[model samples]
Target: MIHRLQNISELIEVSSRMGSDINLIQATGGNTSIKIDGYMIVKASGKHLANAFSENIFVETNPQDYYYNKNGDIKIINPKKSSIREGDLKPSIECNFHALLPKKIILHSHPIEIMAHTMLNSFHSKADLALKGMNWKYINYAKPGEALAMEIAKSMKVDNNIYILANHGLIVCADTVKEAERLQSNVINKLKLNRRVLKDCELESLENIVESIPDAYLPNNKIIHTLGSDEWSLELARKSAYSPDHAVFCGIYPLIIKDINQDWKRLMQGHTYAIIEGKGVILFENSGKYLEDMLLAQAEVFARIPVEESVTTLSINQCKDLVNWEAEKYRKKMLEKLVK
Candidate 1:
């Protein structure tokens, strides 16, 4: 008979293991949770998985009553301590999505290879076809938190072990934490094999691309929009190495806007970044900066892997599939707008 998972420690260990195994969560791009008794054990916000131990993992409130603010941050009502308030420690911004899974354990991550496929518009159907026998659901890109959680809840019926967040990442759920970990591994391994098949078809080149920008483009008040002038290097790295396919979808990089006002203006002006296959892309808006940073970091890590260690590249057909998928996405958006 299956044993019930006992305490917070067990949940913490399981959550930590999932974070370690799936290359999706680096530093802290991903979060994990497990239900015990009436409480949910979730990874503490701003805590890195590599260093996350038991004690500091704050337990603020129950999963059922979690709330989302206007900015999409999660707020929990803590009956225990008034100062130890719901929104006090600020749970993972993605906590609501984690809370919605019917399983005891939920894992989410931004795995690079999987993300490479996810960022492409065409890959979801291809991925669905690829994982034909397994039970899963896919939800299109929505700003994270309440909106995304609501969309997933609407789309999913059966308690599938995995959910693919379109243009984002993967979510795995299982009866036990160990089972969830295993499922996550199996999914990653399959995606890795798919990536290898694509990589083997042809090698994309990155020869003779300009690696440096002129001094004029260097960080200045005009250019340093959101991250401040000090983060210029960080911004540059983000633009340079963000995923190639993401460039096609989200633009080369997001524009760095300071506040909502600037963001609104930029969106109105239609000034967005685009991706190039080998070369890096730039970031524009701060909202997408976290994703850009994560992709850039992953690219850097991949760069260190020797050429022989690299898997096969994606094919033109695969690329075209992504483009077609994006077109459909736009069409759907237009239809929605018309309906509105």
Candidate 2:
């Protein structure tokens, strides 16, 4: 059994570095973990990786105490006994999956390059070709928590160290934290695709809309313009969100606005941002920096999707499942805290 105290320093260092890389993680979207003895120390729910070292965001728990139902619901054998730490901070909802894996260190991230491929309708075929040399495992869509963990458990093998969650993210594991990071880097290098150059468009129209909108409607009461002026971004905004990150953070799809006079709240439903024609994207008053990163990631993912292949987006039911998840709500709350 490894001593948690002995490894805390390295764990903190690795977590912070991984979290700070916007190319690999956005907001509190990804999770990291270290296992010693029967306990798993994981990034607490709602904790950002960039701050994983500075803050007390790790939770110690006995992952064996959790079980899953046929329907994917999680059942903790005993909450009080399961925890090895004192505080309200909760371990990542993915704690069970981390526990089930055989590796000593694990890192999960939502890299845009990886997402760009996973979002494709031909994910199985395309990924098969892209990740030719690696022993990678893929999970069909499973709601986070028991269902997702259960899916991973089924396919995880002793030899395979990389996993791709459909429309979700990537996972890399190794005996050491640095090795895990290396493996993650290698996976990204292998799957990386060239970004598309956006066609030019005029943004003078967006300036007018920004001036007309009340400060109350903008995030931080500041009007932030993004993506809409680029021709590629405009077409992407019109399409449906195909991945879990896009659906959960950006919404089922971006709200396209042609007129500033429309009821902002009514049209936005519960989405975080909107796309205006000939203008650009507009964020809501409550939108946080974490959200802004997600929006940018969406732009990158959309730009990276190859022009020849058509991508399939998540369906309405799939989108509903993600947006309504309680765990995701907590992450959103943490993101909101960051902007304040």
Candidate 3:
């Protein structure tokens, strides 16, 4: 019993620390899990990894077929209770893969550096070279759910642990929390690329336009303005989404206001954010922190892919796949119910 408590405590510590790193996590965008006494304790759908302590953000799922630990493995007869708002918690949509994986500790994260490489047209070769010595594999982008889980299963080898989910994120697995964390750090350091340094925009310049539109406002996070600081990053931001969170949080494509002074309201119709071409980004008053974090993640990802590099953004169909998913709908509903 003491040993089980120790494992759960360690899992919470690692999940909280990883959840707090902006470069690794944003909002409730990532998920973490650990196999304990034959059961999978995974981050609940729409729950913040940072709230592992304050809230019951975990859901315990039993693998119908796969036994977590094979030899004299702990079977924890009565698993820990899993509930939220007097209802049974839902495991992450990505839980299928977690159940299939052999590792005890698993973290599905979206590190900026990994996304940078994913943006490149030739990401497979780059990942191959960067992660040569490590047991790693790069899988093409698949909608998060059973589809993605099946794809990973098709490519995963017995020794493979690091999964570079193209146009998605990274997943590292290990026997213990410490090893999983150490491996995650090593993958980031290995896959890190040189970013295109962007020039800064004078944020004060936007003060003149705030009063023009009733809904328009300058963003609180200064980093979001980087969206318009460079031609490539601005173009990337102007184009389609770089990843799922980008599409789900910020709209598939931000409204591009050629001139912030003109009647830009028509263009912003349903958009959450907008780029004033080369000037900077503007946001609606209700654009929450989750939206801001996703936009900032784009700024970070775009700057890392050199201006000359070829990139691929999600297609309209692909974007629809994510935003329309029932899982995402539930997440949005969950967000609305959380106390601000």
Which structure among the candidates has the greatest lDDT?
A: 3
Instruction: Write one digit per residue (lDDT tens) for candidate 1, span 41-126.
Output: 66655554544454344444466665333444334333222222334345555667666566777878767666555544456556
> Which tens-of-lDDT digit does each residue in 1-340 have in candidate 2?
2366456677788888878887888878789888787677888888888896567778777766665434434443333346555376777777777877778888889888888888777777767887888889988877767677778877778889999987778988899988898889988888887887765334455556656765423333122243565665566566766677667777787777776787765654565577777666776665556667777677777778766567766778878988898778877777667667
**Alpha-carbon error at 137 in model 2, in Å?**
1.1
In order, candidate lDDTs are: 0.49, 0.73, 0.78
Q: Report RMSD for candidate 2.
A: 4.1
Residues 1-340 of candidate 3 have per-residue lDDT tens digits of: 2354356888889888988888999878888888887777778888888888887777777753322333534221212232212255677778777877889999899999998888889888887887888998888888876677767877877699999898889999999889999999999999889876786777667667666777888876776787886777787786778898888888787777676666556655667667877678888766765777787788888879887788988888999899887888888777767736
Q: Which ten residues in a row have the lowest lDDT in candidate 3?
A: 76-85
lDDT of 1 at 137: 78
Question: When superposed on Cα atoms, how far off is each prediction in RMSD?
Answer: 13.6, 4.1, 4.7
In model 3, which runs have C-alpha deviations exceeding 4 angstroms?
Answer: 1-7, 65-88, 262-269
Q: How do the predictions measure up, each by TM-score? A: 0.55, 0.86, 0.89
TM-score winner between candidates 1 and 2? 2
